[model samples]
Target chain A: MRRAFTEELQFISDQLVEMTRLTSTALDRATTALLTADLELAEAVISADDTIDLVRRDLDSRAVDVLARQQPVATDLRQLVMAMRMSSDLERMGDLARHVAKLTRLRYPHKVLRGPLEPMFTRMAEVAEDLVAEAGRIIANNDVEAVPQLLVTDDEMDELHREVFRTLLADDWGHGVEAAIDATLLSRYYERFGDHAVSIAQRVVYLVTGEWPEEDLHIEERMDVSRVEPLG
Target chain B: MRRAFTEELQFISDQLVEMTRLTSTALDRATTALLTADLELAEAVISADDTIDLVRRDLDSRAVDVLARQQPVATDLRQLVMAMRMSSDLERMGDLARHVAKLTRLRYPHKVLRGPLEPMFTRMAEVAEDLVAEAGRIIANNDVEAVPQLLVTDDEMDELHREVFRTLLADDWGHGVEAAIDATLLSRYYERFGDHAVSIAQRVVYLVTGEWPEEDLHIEERMDVSRVEPLG
Candidate 1:
C-alpha cells in the first residue's frame, strides 16, 4: 500500500512537469505568432489550451483519489494539496498564453509589437521561458537551489513590464492610444505568465524545504507597479 | 465523528462567505479611491488585504485538518477540496481589489478615471459588488438559482470592458497614451474580478446540483477580449 501511494505521487509530479512543458511551448509559439501576425500559429495555441486544462483536471482528480484511498497525513497530505495548487498555477500560465494568442488573432495581419515595444516584449518572453523551464526542473528534481535564480528571472520580467510602460508613455511614442492599450494588455499578459511560474517554483521549494522564501513571500505585493505611474 | 465533520464543514462554509464580504468591501472602496484620488482610502484597501490573506490561510489549514481527521471519501472529500478552490478564488478577488488600490495610490492626487471612463467604471464596480455578494449568498444557502443571474452580471461587465476600449480607440480620444495605458489595465482588473466571481458561483452550482453550467464552463476563454481589437 505504501509503495502504491508513492507511485501515485510520482505520477502526479510527472503530470505537473508535463504541464510546464505544454505552457512553455504555448507561450513561445504565442510570442512568435504575435511578432509575425501568424494566424495559423495563434489558432493552434488557442486550441491547444484545452489539452493543458484536461491534464490539470486529470491530475487534480487523481490527487483527490489518492487522498481518499491512502488517507495521507502530515507531510504527505500537504504535498497532495500543494500539488493541486501547482497545477492551478500552471493551468493559469497556459491561459495567459492563450490570451496572448487570442490578442494576436484579434489583430491579425497587423503586428502588435513593433518599434520599441518589440525588443522589450522579446526580452520579456525570454525571461518567461527561463522561469517556466526552471519551475519544471525544480518540480521534477526537488531542486531548491534553482529557486533563487528563478526569482532573479522573475525580477527581469518585472523590469521589462515597467519598460513597456515607459516606452508607451514616452513623449515621442507615435503608436497612438490604440497601440498603447494593446501594449499595456500584452505586457501584462507576459508579466503575469512569469508571476505564475514563480508561484509554482515557490510552492515546490516550500514543499521540499518546508520554509517559504522570506523576501519573496508576498510576491503579489512586490509587483513594483508603483513605478508604473503615468506621466501627467 | 460524522457530526463533528458536519460542524467543521459548516465552519469552512462560513469562512468562505466571510471572504466574499471582505473582497466586496475592498473592491467597492478601491473604486471610490480611484475615482476620487483619495490616497487614504486607497491605503486602507491596500493594508487591509493582508487580513483577507490571513483568513484564507486559516481556512485552508482548517480544511486540511478536517480532511486528515475525518478521512472523508467520495463527496465529502470533494467538498473539502472544492472549499480550498473557492477560498483561492476569493483570495484572488481580494488581490485584484488590492491591485486597483495600489494603482490608485501610485497615482495619488490624480484621478485615474475621467470623462466617459468614469461612468463605465462606476457601473463595473457596481456589477462586481453584486456578483461577489451573490457568490456569498450562493455559498451560504446553496442557492443554485443565483448562478444564472451572476452570469448575466458577468456579461454586463464584459460589455463595459468593450465599451472602455471603444472609448479609448475613438478618433477623438483626448487622453494621452499614459492615461490610456492606465485605463486599459484598470478595465482588465475589474473584468477579471468578475470572472473570478463567476468561477466561484459556478463551482457552488456544480457542487450542489452535480451539473456544471453549460454555457459558462470556460469563463476565462469567453472573456470577449477579441472585441477589444485596436483601431488602425
Candidate 2:
C-alpha cells in the first residue's frame, strides 16, 4: 500500500511537468502566430488549451483521491496540496497563451507585431519559455538550486515588458491607439505568463525548503513600474 | 469527533465568505482612488491586502489540519478540497484589487479615470463589487439559485469591457497612446476581478450539484471579443 502511495505521488508530479511542457509549446506557437499572422497556428493554440485544462482537472481530482485514500500527513500532504496549486498556475499560463493567440486571430492577416518591436517580443517569448521550462525541471528533480536562475529569467521578462511601455510612451511612437492597445495587452499577457512560472517555482521552493522566499507571490506587483503616467 | 470536524469545516466556509467581503472592499476603494486621485485610499487598499493573504494562509493551514486529523472521505473530503480552491480564488481577487490600487499610486495625483470613461468605470466597479458580495452570500447559504443572477451580472461586465475598447478605438479619441494603454489595462483588471468572482460562484455550484457548468470556467475567454483591429 505504501509503495502504491509513493507511485501515485510521483505520477502527480510528472503530470505537473507535462503541463509545463504543454504551456511552453502553446506560448511558443502563440508568439509565432502573432509575429507571422498565421491564423491556423493561432487556432491550433486556442484549441490545444483544452488539453491543458483537462490535465489540470485530472491532476487535481487525482490529488484529492490520494488524500482521501492514503490520508497523507505533514510533508506528503503539503506536496499534494502544492501540486494542485502548481497545476492551477500552469493552466493559467496556457490560458494567457491562448489570449495571445486569439489576439492574433482577431487581427488576422495584419501583423500585430511590426519592425523593431518584433525582436523584443521574440526575446520576451524566449525568456518566458525558459522560465516555464526551468520550472518543469525544478518540479521533476526537486532542484532547489534552479529556482534562483529561473527568477533571473523572470527579471529579464520584466525588463522587456517595461521596454514595451517606453516605446508606446515615446513621442516618436507612430503606431496610433489601436496598435498601442494591442502592444499593451500583448506585453501584459507575456509578463503574466512569466509571473505564473515564478509562482510555480516559488511553490517548489516552499515544498522543499518549507519556507516561502521573502519575495512577492506575483513579481508583476513589485515590478509593475510599467504604469502609465498621465501625459500633459 | 465528527462534530468537531463539522465545526472545522464551517470555520473554513466562514473564512471564505470573509475573504470575499475584504476583496469587495478593496476593489471598491481602488476604484475610488483611481477616479478621485486619492493616494491615501490607494495606499490603504495596497496595505490591507496583506490581511487577506494572511487569512488565506490560516484557512488553508486549518483545512490541511482537518484533512489530516479527520481523514475525511467522500463528501466531507470534497468540501475541504473545494474550500481551499475557493480561498485561492478569493486571494487572487484581492491581488487584482491591489493591482488597481497600485496603478492609482503609480500615477498618483494624476487621475487615471477621466471625463467620459469615469462613469463606465464606476459602473464596472459596482458590478464587480456586487458579484463578489453575491458570491459570499452563495457560499454562506449554499445558494445555487443565486448563481444565474451572478452570471447575468458578469454579462453586464463584459458589455462594459467591450465599450472600453470601442471608446479607445473611436476615431475621435483625443487621448494619446499612454491613456489608451491605461484604459486597456484598467479595463482588463476590472474584467478579471469579475471573472474571479464568477469562478468562486462556479465552485459553489459544483460543490452543491456535483456538476461542472457547461459554460467556460473563465467567461473572459469567451467574452474576450474586445480585440483591437489594426488601423489602415
What tens-digit string does per-residue lDDT give for candidate 2 at B151-196? 9998888888888888889988897877788888888888888888
Worst 10 residues of 2 chain B by lDDT: B223-232
Candidate 2 per-residue C-alpha lDDT over A1-232 given as tens digits, one digit per residue, 9 for 90 to 100: 8899999999999999999999999999999999999999999999999999999999999999999889999999999999999999999899999989998988888999754689999999999999999999999999989988998898788888888888888888888888888888888889889989998888989999998878854443643533423232
Candidate 1 residue spans exceeding 4 A from truth = A227-232, B227-232
True contacts kept of each: 0.75, 0.54
Per-residue lDDT of A1-232 in model 1, one digit per residue for the tens? 9999999999999999999999999999999999889999999998999899899989988999999999999889989999999999998999899998988988778888768888888788889999999999999999988888998888788778878887887778887887788888888888889888888888887788777777554768645356444343
Clashes of each: 0, 0
Error of 1 at A53 (Å): 0.7
Interface RMSD of 1: 2.4
- Candidate 2 wrong stretches, greater than 4 Å: A217-232, B217-232
